[model samples]
Target: MEGRNKCAACFRQFNKMEHLVEHMRISYHSVHEPMCGICRKHCRSFESLREHLIGPLPKVDCERIFKDRGCDLCLTIFSSRNALWAHRSTCQFSRPNNAILYRMASLGIQDELRIDSSRGKAVALACKMVGGGSDGSLDLCARVCLVDEYERIIFHAYVKPTLPVTNYRYESTGIRPEFLRDAMPLKQVSRKIQDYLCNGEPIWQIRSRSGRARILVGHGLDHDLKCLELEYPPMLIRDTAKYPPLMKTSKLSNSLKYLTKAYLGYDTQTGIQDPYEDCVGTMRLYTRMRSLAHRTQDYPLATDPQNRNNYASWRQTELERMSPENLLELSRSDYYCWCLDSN
Candidate 1:
């Protein structure tokens, strides 16, 4: 079966191995794609995925096995009957009894203060932009939201733009002139956010892997920071738009809306976009990527930390001569893999 020239993710078979290689080169499939639990085929959405599983004409093999091992709540397939049975106990997502699960979580500020500060934790940030300039073509940060790994709201504020608001983009932002009228000034908002992100770290102590500072996660985070007139250590930030594995094969960034729906199995930004929801979306995405189980590597890029091997021009002939499947196996992500965060 290894010699049959089938894509491991989409399961598309090719007459020639080179065709499969080309498909992989442009498809940009990663662990983030909405995938079939059994067949491992990537689908555009959960709706399509559901259809593929049990719709009018389902995949017979997958449907048969899914009936036995699939957890209907999360649609995950377990390896054995025991595994499925074990999963059932915790698969109560539809009706979570907050009293039992969120007893400590509801403590809010008290719960947050109890967490140890010596270890680094991820938090998500999102900003709502209102239109500025005459035709409302310029973006102005009018509001922002920040949330923790548990999707708990840490900060939510309406920001008074430094520049006068020309258009509120009310249809999307749900903001009005009155909201900004008494809102926190831009400078104050920026200072407060910076302080929260820095934790207790002084300027000199701030580093890429600082536990004192929160690791910032967001989609188009630079734009959000720019609007706030704040700056953070580059190494301390994780921008979903810039993460190599999450980007398009063309190296272009996908919108948060698209990434959320494609990878998260849900729709977003369909109506008025809420900053807290955006924060949760980015947080979910970051944690999902950070949770990748790629084994620890000792070199370059997505490989071992010590190995700096890249496809140098001197190796062009060697690369060309290798079998297509081997070449595909050799190909690695150009940027740091999020799995290294665990290391």
Candidate 2:
């Protein structure tokens, strides 16, 4: 079978070993991998999983229910259509924002919060939490660490949980009640962090332009931002967990602990987690990625006239006419890389 260039998992035959390797990478058919909850078939990627649910030959029952309650982003099927609707607003590929903003909009504080730009240098921050959620419901923020590009700790604080504590998960959190007893309020912590992120500028202006708000480098930033009830534009966030090349073989995310050990030659979060250590590790990873040479001095911009037409509309022969480098340029990245902006 090996000499015959056969894929054992899918039983597909290939002419060359290189083609088989590419097939294995694309098929990602492993026994231990995640399987579709409906058909129980394993997928190599989320795109393939989506195809299984909605493609031309999709599973009949799964497709029917998915139309009513499926989440396009996570491929999760909610219990009800209403639940699916509620999840849709926040189920975008980017992180979710709470409804807290609607109340602020009604109060007209949205404009009040917008001010001139502050022009701050790029910095990184990381947060740690204990007792994730009440009664196994949600995670709460416990500690935060903000460091500048030079690795200087600009702000560090222990946060008091607004909700009653439930499962401390002490083995990993290493947080004690006494540590948070005298900590800062959640609102106060949020405001201070917002001010730091805003860098004396209004959030609106920072959102509109670059070089004002600092670039945030962290792992699982979506979780951290959600716990703190904070929001930053997705473009400004550099999440190592979500980066494409760093992902697992199945195109799923790899844990920060595994990434740190694999890339940095060390270990972390063995017992209790440390926000500062996480922050430093994330910043190091960010810097390393930013330093990669994509080898193009002038990369194509999204708005370029040549890029105006969607690649899908191009004729097969037209695409075939393109050079490999040109095809690579036309292709989209699996995930957004901040280094692309720098280039």
Candidate 3:
């Protein structure tokens, strides 16, 4: 043990070759490897190697588990039996017999609807329609419509603005106050829209009969609905403007002109977007790229409303009735399956 005459590991002395062999076996164990200094875990390879740092070594019982046809959860398919067991403990797919258990397992995942693959689903597109002047006398318009797979505009109308022009801010990017001042009021616009759609029966009735009302569509629709003073269910609204994924990316700009150019290959910067054309374009874009997601595999599409403090109290009450597992399973599948298959 004097000077450099000792073994590099364990610093044990060796008087002869056989003594050193005995020292190595006893101190390091015949099969057991040295424990890593960092994680305090056993390592099979030399510490200097990069593989030793990241790669996990096979456990002694790994082969036996597979040989005995052991639980897939305890096999060597994953890094550790513990990890595999943990995943199996929560995996809905692992339990095919128990519906309740399957549903409960799905609760850990996200809950977002997916698109169907059979027949294409319809997309609804809406947009704010404004035509006014700088003076208080201005007209605000709102358009809500349904579009088809072929990028055809089906139902379209211009609703009147609920509030006066003075109540609206023109300094915003899309607001053209001066033009709005000279335009008609929300009442006038609503009359025009009602006249157009209700001339015979309602277009909504016709579309609903033809099953076109369930189409997938898009727009900066929330503001449009507000301007129109329309109250519809959240499912009826698929506003691309509020979709976080589209907003985070550069594919669609906040401005209609930019969105048209980027998505529909049309430049609306020169003049006002025809309400019908804007609606169609937004729907086309939404239909084209609605499958993309930004989150990881296990990330929930919608957070639990019960845990959110800012949401309405009624939201929690409604959420309490929904089983998280069922929502998660629905989110994992195609969102438009029902629409496409609803013959």
- Local distance difference test values of all predictions, in order: 0.69, 0.63, 0.39
Clashing residue pairs in candidate 2 are 115-202, 133-138, 133-139
Candidate achieving higher lDDT, 1 or 2: 1
lDDT of model 3 at position 43:
31
Q: Rank candidates, TM-score, best first.
A: 1, 2, 3
Q: Count the backbone clashes (under 3 Å) in each candidate.
A: 9, 3, 25
> What is the alpha-carbon lDDT of model 3 when measured against the actual structure?
0.39
- When summed lDDT is taken over every stretch of 10 residues in candidate 1, the lowest stretch is 105-114
lDDT of 1 by residue, 163-186 (tens): 888898888877767666677788
Per-residue alpha-carbon lDDT of model 2 for 1-343, expressed as tens digits?
7755545533342133334333333432333233466766655444466677877678888899788888764576788999988977653321113135323322322121222233235567777766645365567897777766655566667788888778666677666676677777888887877877777767788889857677878888899888888888787888888875566656688887777765555677665566666776777667756754444523234434553453443354565455543443443322344556455
Q: Which stretch of 10 consecutive residues in model 3 shows the poorest summed lDDT?
A: 332-341
lDDT of 3 by residue, 162-261 (tens): 5544434333213444434444445654444333323333555644453333433456666665566543445544665654323422334366555555
**Displacement of the residue 129 alpha carbon in candidate 1, Å:** 0.6
Residue 237 of model 1, lDDT score: 91
